[model samples]
Target: MVGWLIDAIKKDYQPPISKVKVGKFNDYVQREYDFDKLEKKLLGWE
Candidate 1:
C-alpha cells in the first residue's frame, strides 16, 4: 500500500472537473442560477 501510494503521488492526479470546459465559474455577469431557490432546496425548504 505504501509503494502504491508513492507511485500514485509521483503521477499527476487530474480531477474529474479537469475534463470539463467551462467559462468563468465565479463570474456573475448574467445571473445564471437562482441562488435563493437553490439555498431553499438545499435546506429542504423548497
Candidate 2:
C-alpha cells in the first residue's frame, strides 16, 4: 500500500518552478512589498 502510494507520488511529482520563472517571481515580490519589514512584522519583531 505504501509502496503503491510512493510510486504514484513519484509519477506525479514535477518541479513546481523553473529557474527562469523563479527569478521573475522574486523580482515581483520585492517590487510589490517591503519584504524585510513584512517578515519582521509577521514574526512579531515589530
Candidate 3:
C-alpha cells in the first residue's frame, strides 16, 4: 500500500529547474579549501 503510493508520487513529480553547470576542478578545489578553513576557524581549530 505505502509502496504503491510512493511509486505514484514519483511518477507524477517533475523538477521545476533544469541545467546545472559546474565550474573547473581547480576553482572548485580552491573554494572547498576556503570553506574548510572557515569552518575550522568557526570550530576553534588551530
Candidate 4:
C-alpha cells in the first residue's frame, strides 16, 4: 500500500484540491450527505 501525499511529494505532483483525501478513491467531491434521511429509510420511518 502506498501513501498518496508521500508519493505526490516524491514525484513532485500537485492535486486540484489541497485537502488530504486518505484511504479511499479521491473521486468524491465535498458535498452534504443527508445521513438523517438515510437512517430514517433504514429504520422504515416516515
User: What is the Å distance of residue 31 in model 3 from its true position?
Assistant: 9.5
> Which one is best on TM-score?
4
> Per-prediction count of colliding residue pairs?
0, 0, 0, 0
Instruction: List TM-scores for all candidates, in order.
Output: 0.33, 0.32, 0.27, 0.34
Better of 1 and 2 by lDDT: 1
Q: Output the number of the lDDT-best candidate.
A: 4
Candidate 1 stretches greater than 4 Å from native: 1-31
Predicted candidate 4 versus true structure: per-residue lDDT over 1-46, tens digit per residue: 4698788889999657778657677667888879999899999995
List per-candidate RMSD values in Å.
10.1, 10.9, 9.7, 12.6
- Give the lowest summed-lDDT range of ten residues in model 4: 18-27
Tell me the deviation in Å of residue 3 in model 2: 43
Candidate 2 Cα errors over 4 Å, as ranges: 1-31
**lDDT of the candidates, in the order given:** 0.81, 0.79, 0.77, 0.82
* Tens digit per residue, CA lDDT, model 1, 1-46: 9987787788955556566677888778676898899999999997
Off by over 4 Å in 4: 1-31
Candidate 2 local lDDT, 1-46, one digit each (tens): 9997898798995657755634554564335788899999999999
Query: Runs in model 3 with CA error above 4 Å?
Result: 1-33
